[model samples]
Target: MTTISALPLLDGTSIPALGLGVYKVDDTTARNSVTTALEAGYRLVDTASFYRNERGVGRALKDSGVLRDDVYVTTKLWNDAHGRGKTRRAFKDSVKRLNTAPDLYLIHWPCPARGLYAETWRALVELRDDGRVRSIGVSNFQRHHLETIIEDSGEVPVLNQIELHPYLQQRELRAFHAEHRIVTQAWSPLGRGAVLADETIVAIAAAHRVSPAQVILRWHLDLGVAVIPKSVTPDRIRANLDVNGFALTPDDHDRIAALDRGARVGSHPDEVK
Candidate 1:
């Protein structure tokens, strides 16, 4: 089994560097994928209330026999649940479905149009104070959105999950995160398969004798960014966790860095609402 690495959060908790994501998958697929991933040595699982598979993820965690403390489970509050009261209630509902408080709870989107994210951030701070969650963070938030919440609540998110890959490296926002001691995590880390066919990535994979996906994932790991690659296929699921053997070279980083085009596979933060 691969010895999965981890990244430490400002809140004093650490999350596995690479994990599995359940985005469009159904409950059955989520359960099976979580089971396979746990057995294959993955210690992190990222899901969201929007995914509607928290029950399945919880089932796998309960039956996998991997002690809950050893597994880092992260879930999120959906856009519709962006208010102090609604955020609190939405978190409880998610925990009820999962049968345990999540180690990390994230706001799924900024939904700036709704103008409730700052209020939601205050509620997350309250939840943290109440011991309802281990830590709180945000997803798909741009620098301005992060600033709004941080400035209003006087609490910085422990991590910011975004659509990041070689095609969209997010260097500017990442620098802001570094300034605030916030961890940057990648969603759609593979660029949703668009980055897999790049000649540069393919060449790196050929040189390393691994899949193009592995090369891309290894690149994110080398950059100290947390990544969650999603797949329902068992072979692919296990293969995604097998990137511990090799490291990316400096020349490889330069080649891959040249691939950035500011392309995005997911919705932009400002357009989500």
Candidate 2:
């Protein structure tokens, strides 16, 4: 089992640097995958109400025998659930489904078109204040969305989870996050298998005698970002966490940096709504 480290968030809390993501995983698969991850020493599990697997994830945690305080679980409110009343109610529903208060709650997306994200952010702050959640963050938020919410609510998100990978580096947005002390977390750290086939990443993996996925994950760690790579296969789930052996050189980073082509396998924030 690999022991992952933690990074401190701005809110005086810490999160496991690496975690399991159950984006498209079915409820039954989520239960098994989360159980596998926990047994492999993963202390963080990222899910969302949108994923529709909170019940399975919650059951895994309860059955895994891992103490509640030892795991850092995260869940998000979907786009349609954005608003003061809806956000609070959505959170309550998630807590009930999760069978525990989530350590971190996030605004799943900015959904700028709806014009309710700012109000939704305030509701998240309220949840944190009410002690319903330990930390609050956002996902897929562009710079303008972040600024708008911060300006409106006077509360900056503790983290921003985004579609980031070797192909879509989002350097500018990451810099902005650094300015605000918000941790940058990559949702699809592998570029949805796009980067796995790139010659640059493949060569690096060969050099380290590790799989392509490990090289990409190692690169993500080197970039000072959190990553949640999802997989239902037990072997891949275990392999994803076995990235602590080798280190990436400056040359490797530069090579991967050059591979950035502004490519995104996921939807843009502006187009989501």
Candidate 3:
């Protein structure tokens, strides 16, 4: 079995650094894909309520014959469920659909305009204290949002999931995460397949005798970011997990680092509300 290394969170919990992302995949596809990934030796699975496939993910988990404790599962609370009581209900619903307790729970977005995320954070904190979730974190949060959470609640999220790839380095936010002992989880780690065909990434892939996706995933690993790359195809899912064996050269790393243009394919946190 080829097991990738794990990343430790501020709470002393460790999560697999690479996982299968089930974002747009539907129920049937998500179930089959997740089953295949588990059978292929993947121990981490990322899904969310917004993805609308937690039930399928749960079915796959049961079908895979993998123990609940052995697999690290993560799910998120959607933007609309940002208040304390609503977040509590949302967690219960997600857990019911997943059919297992989540190892890490995350806020899907900041949603500052709604002005409910702070209370949601408190509910997450309470969940952590109540032992339903092993760890809690946020997604698509900038440095300012992180500061607000820390300032208001006197608690720091264990991880921050963001749209990160070679093209959007997010250096400052990553630095802030590091300083605060928060793990940086990359959600569109391959730039949603946009940059995989780039000449630079292609050349790096050619030089390494790997796919461009592999090269980009390697860059994420080298930068110490946890990545979740979603794929319905069996081969692509396997290839995404087969990035642990190679190393990217210093120059290659620098070249990819230079590709940053701050390009964001997703909505900004402040605007998402």
Candidate 4:
């Protein structure tokens, strides 16, 4: 099992730097996947109402015999639930489906066209104040959206979950996060398998006698960012967590850095709504 490390958030809470992401997997698959990941030493699990498998994630945590406090489970409020009351209901529903309080809760998107993320953020603030969630943050929020929330609530988010990878590195946003002391969590940390076949990454993996995916995951960790790579297959899940054994060379890191081409396999944060 790999010894994944943790990164501290602005609020003093810490999250596992490597995690399991259940994006399109069904509830049954999600449950089994979480179980497999936990057995492989993953302590963080990322889910969302948009994923529609919180119950499966919750069940796996319960059945895996891992203490709830030992695992960090994160879920997000969907975009439609952007108002004060809707946000509250959505959170309650998420909790119900999760069958336990989420360690971290996040606003899924800025949804700029709705003009309601600020209100949604306020609701998350209230949840944190109620001690229902250990930390609160956002997903796919740009700098301006983050500024609006901090300006309105005087509270900085614990982290921002975004579509980050070798491609679409979001250098400016990461710089902004570093300045504010907010953790940056990458959702599609592998670029949805696009980077797995990259010549540079493949070469690095060959040099290290590891998989290309491991090289990419290690690259994210080397940058001090959190990554949640999704896979239901047991071998890949285990391999993803098996990145702690090796370190990337400076020359290899530079070659992988050169692969950034501002590509995105997912939606742009500004246009998500």
Q: Per-residue lDDT of 200-256 in model 4, one digit per residue for the tens? A: 888899999999999999999999999999999999999999987889999987897
Instruction: Extract clashing residue pairs from model 1.
Output: none
Give lDDT tens digits, candidate 1, residues 4-105.
Answer: 888999999899999999999888889999999999999999999999999999999999999999999999999999999999899999999998889999
lDDT for position 121 in model 4: 94
Work out the TM-score per prediction: 0.99, 0.99, 0.98, 0.99
lDDT of each: 0.94, 0.93, 0.92, 0.93
State how far residue 258 of model 3 sits from its true place (Å): 0.8
Positional deviation of 259 in candidate 2, in angstroms?
0.4
Q: What is the lDDT of candidate 2?
A: 0.93
In terms of TM-score, how similar is model 4 to the real structure? 0.99
Could you list the CA RMSD of all candidates, in the order they appear?
0.7, 0.7, 0.8, 0.8
